[model samples]
Target: MCDECNQYFAKKIEKRVLEMPYFRDVRHRNFIESKKRRIPVSKGIIGGAVDLKKRKDFGTEVIVNSPDIFQKILNGEVKHMIIPVNDQPIEDNKLISRFIAKIAIESAAQTFSSKKGWNNFIINTPEFKELRYYARFGDKLDMWNYSQRRIYNETDRFLNPKVSDGPYEVLHEQNLVFLRDRELYFVLVLFGIEYVISITNPKIDGYKSWLIENNNKCPIIEKNERDTIKGERYF
Candidate 1:
């Protein structure tokens, strides 16, 4: 499912919770429960500090308060975990906590433009510390997707320019990168984050050879090349 689907379903559950009068009654309730009942297993408290920069481009890094939550994910308890790709340290700033809470609120609330708006909201939050060096690996993956889409659409346009095919008309291949769980376990243990391949489909000229050639080029980054003992280049 896409990001929107994830947000929409989260919002539906949040709305149902808010409809209860007991929610306000337990305003000061502890992290996971309310006056009405215990919070479900699917939900947990997540807090974090994130920094974003758009020097000549955009990059974001977040250090969350809940590394244990990530451990739970690694253990197969959390399914749909969207942890930040960067492994920065948590700032000793409390004011920034509120900004993080707001983003969590928006993400859970599933409001429109919440992602972009929350980025701005966090940057302006008062206790905002010095701008840490930003991470662009995620952005690099995003750029690859955009580049693939551009090639896909331009080909489509060349083939049929009379009408617009809309966004979904472009075909995207599902690319998967295999990783050793043990290797990731160690990396996450140390850095709290692990780099992953940003897979893409390369549209080449011709049919059978095109498929074979692109399949060969499918993994822009190779496996086992980034283990901690190694220099560890990103995908």
Candidate 2:
């Protein structure tokens, strides 16, 4: 992307996504620090919420959001403050779709860099026109739909026998999968929440169909090329 477009994405799309209630909390849980190396705080209020911060020098610190709430707690008048957990199943579809589109196209460009002429093909292809326009310009479409689901808990650990640490957390994971319909979908997992987007078009029915056919299997797991219909994009 050009400098101007990069700045636009950084300020408008990426920042908003990072500070989103769910993503921010996930970042906090996975210790995914920002470019400035500061972890975010949660702001989800679905079940009410509290403010707290982790301290390297000490224990968890309760960063009060409201003086009134703090005073109430001090006076023993507070009942409870539920720390934010679990956002709405979906939020900010348009912004997120653009974000996904931006990353998808970028990833494809990078993936195709050594393939000779593929990067130019990606730039010129009409199949990605909507995604490119929407991601960079932000006015091509009102909203683009994607599929989101929690395949695991935010803090869940996976065991890897080869690793000395034993069970370890997955901060994030991503991959591309080709479906039988010849559509490519980008799957990204952040703190165990998986977000999938169809790159050839705005719809995600291809991914949904894949799940239904596979008995609701998580798409992030590597699949044999035979598992995909003539798969070449599963790398």
Highest lDDT model number: 2
Off by over 4 Å in 2: 43-50, 65-67, 87-92, 162-165, 223-235
Q: Write one digit per residue (lDDT tens) for candidate 1, span 65-177.
A: 46775566457775552323211223321222222222233332343245767555434543221111011111122221111111111112112233343222222222222
List, in order, the clash count of every candidate structure.
Answer: 0, 0
TM per candidate: 0.15, 0.83
User: Could you tell me how far off, in angstroms, the CA of residue 115 lies in candidate 2 after the best superposition?
Assistant: 1.1
List model 2 lDDT by residue over 107-137, tens digit each: 8787788897986798788877767887887
Clashing pairs in 2: none
Which residue segments of model 1 deviate by more than 4 Å?
1-87, 90-92, 111-235
Give the Å error, residue 103, model 2: 1.2
For model 2, the run of ten residues with the poorest summed lDDT: 226-235
